[model samples]
Target chain A: MKARVFIRLKSEVLDPQGQAIESALKNLNENNIKNIRQGKLIEMDIEAKNVEEAKKSIENITVKLLANTVIEDYKIEIE
Target chain B: MKARVFIRLKSEVLDPQGQAIESALKNLNENNIKNIRQGKLIEMDIEAKNVEEAKKSIENITVKLLANTVIEDYKIEIE
Candidate 1:
């Protein structure tokens, strides 16, 4: 089974990296850019017997290892 | 307007960070994990008058500034 996890920073958290990218874009004449927030996308392939099992494993992995729950939120999609 | 960009490394590329994370997951007893690949998601808010303009600007930004076209592929979604 294949699973994808999209990890994003909480709205309240300050993203310096995003700000840095935003500044870089502005310097490149992308003046229409307003705000930029950066996150992570993790793609995993697991040896599972079924889709339900895969989803469960992915959810646990996402919460425990993939994302910093304190400041980031993650969504899981299984295929 | 809001746009999201998903940047992923090409399959031929070796991702050391993904390997490191995979090792960490194994140490945590995630034995079912087979393979892991990591990527980036960039969320941007731009000052565009229409969806077509937003999509065009996002595509340009993605190609020129967000992704290194040599070894990475990026997909853009505008809303």
Candidate 2:
């Protein structure tokens, strides 16, 4: 199975990296944009019996290694 | 409009960060995973008349600032 994990900072958290990107865009005259947020996308192939198993496995991996639970949230997709 | 940009390394390029994560996962007994790739996900709100305009604007922003076309590929989604 192929699994995807989308890890994003929680909305309430400050994202300085994202703010930097937004400022850069503004400097380049992309004035229409706002509230820019940045995150991580992880894609991998996993050996699993079914989609459910893959999702579960990936979820475990995400919580343990991919995301900082105190400030980041993650969503998983399996295919 | 809401725009999402997914920026990923080209398949032929090396991703040392992803490899490190994969190694760590293996050390933690996640033996079922392989071919791990990491990418960036950027989300923002933009002022546009319609979805088409939103996509075009985001595409321009992505090409100009978000992605390094030489070694990375990017996809834009607008909603």
Candidate 3:
């Protein structure tokens, strides 16, 4: 099975990197863009028997290693 | 409108950061995971007339700034 994990900073956290990108875009004339935020996407193959198993394992992996629960949130998808 | 841009390295490119993560996972007893890859996800609001226009603008921004065309590919989604 293939899994994808999307990890993003919590809504209340300040993202300096995202702000930097927003400013850069503004300089490039992308005035219509707003509230720019950046996140991480991790794709991996898992040796699981079914979608449920893959999702469960990926969720565990995400909570333990992929995301910092204190400041970030994560979602997992299995295919 | 809201937009998301996913930027990933080309298949042929090597991802050392992903490799490091994979090894770390192995050390942490996640032996079932393999072929790990990492990418970027950008989320933002777009002041466009419609989804089509938002997607088009995002594509342009992705190609010009978010992704390195020579080594990465990007997908844009507008909602």
Best by DockQ: 2
Winner on TM-score (1 vs 3): 3
**TM-score of chain A, all candidates:** 0.92, 0.96, 0.94
Model 1 Cα lDDT, one tens digit per residue, B1-79: 8889999999999998899889988878988886788999999888888988888888887888889999999988887
The clash count of every prediction, one per candidate, is 0, 0, 0
Docking class for model 2 is high
Q: What is candidate 1's CAPRI-style docking category based on DockQ?
A: medium
Better of 1 and 2 by DockQ: 2
Displacement of residue A9 (Cα, Å) in model 1 is 0.7
- lDDT, candidate 2, B1-79, per-residue tens: 8889999999999999899999999888999999999999999999988888889889888898999999999999887
Number of the top candidate by TM-score? 2
Query: What DockQ number belongs to candidate 2?
Result: 0.93
Identify the superior model by TM-score, candidate 1 or candidate 2.
2
Candidate rank order under DockQ: 2, 3, 1
Angstrom error of the Cα, residue A43, model 3: value is 0.2
Q: What DockQ do you compute for every candidate structure?
A: 0.79, 0.93, 0.90
**Candidate 3: tens digits of C-alpha lDDT, residues B9-65:** 899999998898899898779899999999999999999888888888898888888
lDDT of each: 0.89, 0.93, 0.90
